[model samples]
Each structure stands twice: as structure tokens, then as C-alpha cells.
Target: MTDEFAPTRFSHVKAGENGWRSDGLRDFFLYRDLGVAEATEGKVICHLVKANMAPEKGTGWHRHEAHFQIVIMTKGWARFMYGDQDTLVSAGDCVHQRPGIVHYLYDYSPDMEYLEIVSPADFKTVEMPAPAEVPPFTPWS
Candidate 1:
């Protein structure tokens, strides 16, 4: 195998193996790292995130500074504004967020949960003004 495509170490994580903590992206969403960050040595990071505390205002328009990112909804559903398009992501739905694509997650069900995988364990988020008028946020109970 090429050095760039190195053989990653073995990693086995149970669903409840790790504890959840507040995510840097949003305080209302809790995150649990799946050990991919350490296993890959900052090359990639995988984590499970779920709704913890409902916020009056949801995640506004923002973009992540990374090479790649993807989200797989594990439970419930969420509505997001991807550029000029409004997308509804439900359980089992997977979405690949292109680099630097601005998006706003405006609404979600109470049981919202997802698995996010991104390249580079440490990434940056840039908040930007909405390209279009955002819809009213519906609070999650």
C-alpha cells in the first residue's frame, strides 16, 4: 500500500462506549468521538452527534474549512438550507457536504442523531451571512 494510503490501526467502539460532550459547532448538540481521530492521527475524525438541549435559534449559516465531510442521519430528521436549496435529511440518509459549502440546520426532530465524518481531526468553521433569507427556526422540545 502507498504511504499516503497507510494501513490504519484497528478501532472498535460500541454504541455506548464513550461519553457524550458538547460539540464545538453547537452547544445544543452533544458529540461522541468514535476514536477515528486518534486512530488516523488527525487525518480523519468520526463522531456521533445528537440533540441535547433545544435552542431557540438553530445553527445559522456556516461552513467548515476541511477537505471533506459527510453526515449520516441515524435517528429522526432534520431540515437544512444547503446553499439556495432546502434539504430534509431523515434517518438512514447520508449527505456529503462539499468543502466550504455554506449550510444552515434550521429544524430537527427531538430524537435527531447523526454520524459525522470529516478529514483532519481539527477543523475550522466560518460563520457567514445567509445567501438567502432563512426560514423561522422551530424549537425542538
Candidate 2:
């Protein structure tokens, strides 16, 4: 039997090695690449995301085209909706987003930050109709 998978290498990303960039999926947030994509040969991606601006309008209803994905809240908190179910992800919280699950991130704190890991490095996010109304975001003082 032949192995169908390419070998992956060890990767280490030190803090301050990569600066956060605004060219992420959302303009209201910044992303810091953790060097996992290159090391894994595009098989996966790991990154840290943090709020860049106040949440006037959060990430609208959308879903990602990924086989596996998870968001681990590292700081602050965020409120998300998974098909009409309101979920508040606080610091140290982790959420596994099932593939093709329609969701919305409607609110978050000023210091909200999370680590996101997804398979297949490159993923497509498709916008979808809102399942329910979103709540107002807390004003940042």
C-alpha cells in the first residue's frame, strides 16, 4: 500500500516573530499567523485573532467550507449564534464549529482574542441569511 499523505515538518512560532495583520477574513479583526500552514504544507492553519476595532457590526451570518475547525478564546469574550442558539464564548472557552453550520458572531469585548485552527489551510467563507436577530454589542469604555 502506498501512503497518500505528504510528510509534515515540525514548526515553532515564537511570540513577536510575526506581527498581526489586518488582511484577514474580517476587517474588524487582526490575524497573526502561527506558521502552521507553511509547515504543514497547506494541510492546516493555526492563527491568533484579536479585535481591531469596536464591534459596530460583528461578523455577519456566515459559514466556512472546512472539514474541521475550532476556536479557542484566549482573552476576553465573544457572543455567537449557531443556528438560533446564542452562545457566549469567554476566555478559556473552546468551540468546535461543525462543517457548514450557519453562524454569526454578533458581539465581542474590546480585548477579545481567540486562537483558530482549521484544516486545509485555505477555507472558503460563504455568507448566509441570519437565523435570528443579533443583540447589541457592549460599548467599549
The TM-score leader among the candidates is: 2
User: C-alpha displacement of 73 in model 2, angstroms?
Assistant: 0.3
lDDT of 1 by residue, 17-133 (tens): 888988457898999989998888888999999988665678888999999999999999888999889899999999999999999998888899999999978989899998987
* Candidate 2 clash figure, as a count: 0
Once model 1 is optimally superposed onto the true structure by TM-score, how far is the C-alpha of residue 111 displaced, in angstroms? 0.2
C-alpha root-mean-square deviation, each candidate: 1.5, 1.6
Worst 10 residues of 1 by lDDT: 132-141
In order, candidate lDDTs are 0.88, 0.93
Put down candidate 2 lDDT per residue, 14-53, tens digits, no spaces.
9979899999999999999999999988989999999999
How does each model score on TM-score? Answer: 0.92, 0.94
